[model samples]
Target: AQSVAQPEDQVNVAEGNPLTVKCTYSVSGNPYLFWYVQYPNRGLQFLLKYITGDNLVKGSYGFEAEFNKSQTSFHLKKPSALVSDSALYFCAVRDTKTGFQKLVFGTGTRLLVSP
Candidate 1:
């Protein structure tokens, strides 16, 4: 089974300040990790992914995440946050052991950026 955990329910940040949303996962095989963001009443949009290569992966809207194998964590980061950056973020993991791609998503973390 594959699962993702987003420990924080909400994160508040000021505009121009850096922000981070944390996520951790568990999987049977090599994990395919992803982060997605959703605005109010909208569907999730892909942010970034960690399939292979560098530990740090950059994504859309100036978002990036660092994949830590030892800790089984993928924490999303933004160098500078904007008011528009406020949204609900989700962390997901694919279960390779099933031979089928089954994405398990975290509960989601709401980011609030104030001006």
Candidate 2:
């Protein structure tokens, strides 16, 4: 079975400082990894994805992720974070080996950015 793990339950950062949300995945085959952010009273928004090819993937709102096949990790990063960036982040994965393209999501990590 495919699974995603987000070790940290919450990440706290000061505004304008760099932030990272760690994610590691396990799958039978090549994995399709994704990151999503959910704001208060809002649905999950697509942040980035790593389907194939590049090791580094960029996404919305100055967010980027590095896909490390060796480590089986895809950690989300930002040069500088804003207070508005505070939200719940999730890591998900889909196993390419299976015909069913169901995504397995992590528990979720809450990010808090303070001024």
Candidate 3:
């Protein structure tokens, strides 16, 4: 009973502006959260993860995320978006009871950037 949903199929962004991809989750117990990015024909790259402490967690490529407990959500954010940032974003959740290693990925949210 652990899963994630990325509501937006894709997001179009400019070269420089704030960007966000939304995610929501359902789990039996406390969840381990993660964010990953995928390039064309590639697997996912770890962006960030939330195991415990600090609602705000920072990660690779100037990306960060806020873990909201009450809302049962983790949303990824970036102050300045880049053309290079154009890729697919995935939000995931791992069940704490299940060793927190099995990641359930979202359908994936494509991020398109234009120069």
Candidate 4:
């Protein structure tokens, strides 16, 4: 089965420091990977995706990810984090065979960025 695993339940970091939220996945054949962030009660905001291309893919809010096929990982990264960047992050994988774009998301990672 296609699945995404976010090992960390929460990540705390000082403001302006680099940040990372780990993610690992398993899928049959090829798959689409995505990252999204949610704030409070609001819906998830799309961050990035790795369809197929170079190992490194960039996204909004100065975030990026490196798709490592051998390791079956796609960890999110940011050079300089901000207090405002704090939120709940979810790593997901596209279940294409389902014939729907339904995304299987991780439990979630709470990003506690402190000033």
Which 10 residues in a row give candidate 2 its minimum summed lDDT? 94-103
lDDT score, candidate 1, position 46: 97
Q: 92, model 1: CA deviation in Å? A: 0.1
The local distance difference test score of each candidate is 0.96, 0.95, 0.90, 0.94
| 1-115 per-residue lDDT for model 1 (tens digits) | 7899999999999999999999999987788999999999999999999999999999999999999999999999999999999999999998776678778899999999999
**What TM-score quantifies how close candidate 4 is to the native fold?**
0.96
lDDT of 3 by residue, 12-70 (tens): 88878899889998988777889999999998899999989999999999999998889
Runs off by more than 4 Å, candidate 1: none
Error of 3 at 55 (Å): 0.4
Task: Report the error of model 3 at residue 81, Å.
Answer: 0.4
For model 2, name the residue pairs that clash: none
TM-scores for all candidates: the values are 0.97, 0.96, 0.93, 0.96
Task: Sort all candidates by lDDT, best to worst.
Answer: 1, 2, 4, 3
| Per-model root-mean-square deviation over C-alphas | 0.8, 1.0, 1.3, 0.8
Provide the clash count, candidate 1.
0
lDDT of 2 by residue, 1-115 (tens): 8899999999999999999999999988788999999999999999999999999999999999999999999999999999999999999998665678778899999999999
